[model samples]
Target: MILPIVAYGHPILRTIAKDIAPDYPELNQLIADMWETMYYSNGVGLAAPQINRDIRIFVVDSKQIFENMEPGEKNEYPGDEGIREVFINAHIKTLNGDDWPYNEGCLSIPKIREDVYRPEEVTLEYVDENFESKVATFTGITARVILHEYDHIEGKLFIDHIKPLKRKLLKSKLDDISKGKVKVDYRMMFAK
Candidate 1:
């Protein structure tokens, strides 16, 4: 099912999501619907908050399967073993490195892209859809995707990662969004 995506300035987007507790009813179904919504919307990742659910959960498939394939390629593989990963009540433990810059964008921020610095790699511990505990290390695009979605669980947006000057320039536009004066163009903004 295609769920309505919450836009920038939505109160839920700025509020920290509550942690998912064990034995939550319909947790499995919720995760499944999140995956369905993500694929239907052509999004590589979707956070619970983005769907107006304030829970520390998100879905990610960052192997570029949603993007166009190169010529002569019969089949495109996302390469990540777990194509659709569900992170619940997640926490990160930095494994190494200080920080590195990477260009980032958000599903909520439509048409905006900017460079943000974050840990190049990280060790994450979280519960799976079945509430099974797990831990793993991630790097590169996968790491980037994880970090991006993780921010949503904490009431943070990618725009907050931009330089002060850039953020200042965008303040008015953000204000318009907060006031519901602008509509988000998801297709043009997220299509790769």
Candidate 2:
């Protein structure tokens, strides 16, 4: 099932998501539906808040980004391989390495890509779909995607990292998105 993504300005997007227990109802089904919704919406990552669920759950598939790069285009981050995984109740253990800027976008804020600066590597503690806790480190593009989704659970958005002037300029556009005035290919539920 492809769930409707919550649009920008939605209160759920700003509210911090709660951690889920292993016995959360239909856990497997929700994860499956998330994956389906993500692919259907052509997104590299999706967070629970994006689907109107206030839970610390997200899925990322950075491999698709690497694979879809144009031919002859050099990889920006050398030796950076992609990863595909799910993160549940994720906590940022550490953010190391230099900060780099990348054009980031969200399924909830469609057609609004912005350059966001993020650390090159991130150490995270999270559980998988099975609820087994694990700690792992991610780097390069993969890490950026994870951090982006991680922000969702933290009640933060990539736009928050931009300059105030930029945000001010985009005020009307952002308002349009919340009012369901923006057109997107995927289904989205606006707060207004």
TM for candidate 1 is 0.82
Q: Which residue pairs show collisions in model 2? A: none
- Residue 186 alpha-carbon offset, candidate 2, angstroms: 0.9
Which pairs of residues collide in candidate 1? Answer: none
lDDT of 1 by residue, 96-173 (tens): 656778778777776567889987677899998878899888765677789899999999998888889999998887
Cα RMSD of all models vs. native, in order, equals 5.1, 1.1
lDDT of model 2 at position 70:
75
- Cα deviation of 85, candidate 2, in Å: 0.6
For model 2, the superposed segments whose C-alpha errors exceed 4 Å read 71-74
lDDT of each: 0.76, 0.92
Q: How close to the true structure is residue 69 of candidate 2, measured as C-alpha lDDT?
A: 85
After superposition, the stretches of candidate 1 with alpha carbons farther than 4 Å from their true spots are 65-83, 181-192
